[model samples]
Structure formats: structure tokens, C-alpha cells
Target: MRTGRPRQFDRDEAVRQAMHLFWENGYDATSLSQLKAAIGRGITAPSFYAAFGSKEKLYKETVACYLHSHGRVTDALWDDTLPPRQAIETTLLRSARMQCETGHPKGCMVALGVMSANSEEHRHLLAPLDTARARTREGFIRCVKRGVENGELHAGASPDTLGLVFNSFLFGISTLARDGVPLSIIETSVRQIMALWETFSVKNGNELPNG
Candidate 1:
């Protein structure tokens, strides 16, 4: 009987494990040795290099995986079916919940992973994080513009101002989640902050949707 050889390691699972290490320690703080240890199954340094090229390359892959998986919730910002306010609210609430999940590192991977880039190499590895944040701001701006166009917001409202405020609030929530704030408290805070959105809305008895 000829039996095929067993796979060396689960590549997808290895990437996920490495993602958690990077999420916990950020770029410069994480090390190749730490990554090798985390990947487990006796993955050697040569094996790590063969599988992922370099530490920077692996981190990039890990970030992509994280965004594609844990960060997909923010895609709601582009969902035209949802009212602008609802889309923004859904993104914040979902982000808060994901940040506080028990099994993963606290706070957002994108928000926390790129805070202290110590070198050009580190910053280069972190470019995607910056792009993600920029996209988030842009998405909020588009949502605000949609609100104005849909008659949900005042015609003279500034999308840039509203987008900045909400984007800052969302990032602040990520910091708060990392600082150990409970999800319930964060959700309550979201409700209060969203009330401010209603004050800017068009004056036709429109109300912010209750969660």
C-alpha cells in the first residue's frame, strides 16, 4: 500500500497564528524567533523563510488575512442598502465587538499594529495599515455625502467634518477597547455619540435608528 506523505504544516493556520502574534506585539516589537515559535509544529527558521519569504512579508500576509477575516465587518460602510447613519453605526458596533472578543488580541489589528514604526522598513511593512485607515475615512466621507444626497442630512452639511469626527471616534473606540473597557460600556457610548448624528440630520422628524 502506497500512502501519500502527510502535509508538513497547515499554512493557513500558521498564518493565522502569526497574525495573532503580530496583532499582540506590533511590527518592530515582534521577532522572527517569536513568529517561528508561534507557528509551532516544529516549524524551523528555514521552513518559515521558505513558507513566507521574510518576517516583513509574513506580517503583510498576516495583516491581509486579518483584514479579510476580522475586518470584513467594516464593508457595511459601502452597503447602499443601509442608511448612511446605520452603516456608520453598524461599523462602529461591529468593530467594538470584534475588538473585545475573548480569544483575540484586544483592540483593532490595523489600529494597533502600526502605531510605532521605528524604521523605513517597519513603516513600509505598515503601509497597508495606513491605507486601511485612509479608506475608512474615505468610506465615512462617502456615507456622509450619501446622507446629504438622500435628504437625510442638511444640504449644506460638510461631509469632511462629519467624516473626521466619526473616524476619530471609531479609532478612539479601538484605543478604549485595548484599555480594557467593557463592550457594554462601549455600545452605550456608541448610542450617545450617534445621537449627535441625528442633530445634524435633516429636520423632517428623522431619527437615528435604535440598535
Candidate 2:
């Protein structure tokens, strides 16, 4: 006989497992039984129901898990060391890389979910998705403001306009990737987008580190 694995499942771990499941397959495709199996916690349906209330609640928890884990992009982009435009480029490239990388599921959960408008719950899900986008754009605005203060970005550039333009472009890229755009095309497109932003940055004026 051999020693067994850890006895109890951590709630966070379970939620992470659920996040992967939901990320791989949308809410409508993933069943409660399937979630039980995917989590590998030997969880009973009644237990899951009692704890999470319903699949909808479980999905909300999964979104929370996704946000908490991936929100680092916003944090990193807002770092003061990088020029605002370059920071936006870095975040977009990283996000594009994630969409093309193996092991993890491709595409954004929000964009993928928004593709269909079949149900009220599905439509409701777009709210948090939009909120995430808004939060990301806000981060960009803050970064641009910091860049302006330090003269790392163009002084005349409107932060609001730049934020909307960059955010809209990023959302479009995510939508394309979510819709199964080819990896090569995604890479090339993202690189071009980054290059465009790089041209407008104050890096050439000796404002940012290493450009």
C-alpha cells in the first residue's frame, strides 16, 4: 500500500478547475455532472448546489477566478517604468501570445461568450465582460497620464482618445482570436499593431527606458 494524495480539495483549487472547464467549454456546453468530473473532487451534486447555489453562480465564481488570475496584465501595463504606448503594446502582445500558445485554451472567455446571444443569462454575462474591458481601458488611461507626466508619451495626445482606440483594437484582436483566427495571422497582426503604437511613443525622444 502507498500513501494517498492530499485528502481535501481546496475551494480555490476547485474554482480554478472550474475556470479551466468553463474556459475550454462555454457555460451552456458544460454540465454540472461534467463539472463534478472535471474538478475531480468527488463532489456531490447536492453539495455543489448547496455551496454555489446554481451553475450560474458557479460560472460567476469562475469569472472571478479568471479575473483574479489574469488581471496582472493590467497591473503590469500600468507600471511607471514603461512608456504608456509601449506598455499598451506589451499587454496586447502578451494577450495575443496567450491566444496562440499551446496547453492553455485559445481565445478569450468574454469574447467567446459574447458571440452568441441565445439566452438572457448569456446576454447578462456580457455585463461583467464589458466591465473587464472598461477596467482594462481605465488602466491604459492611467498609464498614459503617467507617461504624459514624465514626458514618455506625446504631450498633445488625448488620453481618452488613445484609450478608446487602443482598447477597441485590442478587443477586436481578442474577438478574432476567439473566433479561431489563424495563429500566424494573429501574431503578424499583433506585431503590426504594436509597431504602430511604438512609432507614436516618446521612446525615440529618450523618455522611456530601452524604448
Q: Largest lDDT belongs to which candidate?
A: 1
Q: Pull out the clashing pairs in model 1.
A: none
lDDT by residue for model 2 over 1-211, one digit each (tens)? Answer: 8854433567777788887778778777788898877665567776676657888888889887777765355565667687666677787777776765665566666556554234775768657766887788887777667666777666765677667776777667656776788767876776776664445467675333332
* Model 1 alpha-carbon drift over 4 Å, by segment: 1-7, 204-211
Residues 1-211 of candidate 1: C-alpha lDDT, one tens digit per residue: 9754444889999999989888888888888888888885567877888889998888889989988999786898999999999999999999999999888888898778557366875788877888898899899899999988988887777899888888888888778988899999999998988887787787656654433
Per-model TM-score versus the true fold: 0.90, 0.71
- Relative to the unseen true structure, what is the Cα RMSD of model 1? 4.5
lDDT of 2: 0.69
Q: Report residue 172 deviation for candidate 1 (angstroms).
A: 1.1
Best-performing candidate as measured by TM-score: 1
Runs in model 2 deviating more than 4 A are 1-11, 41-43, 113-118, 121-127, 147-149, 179-185, 198-211
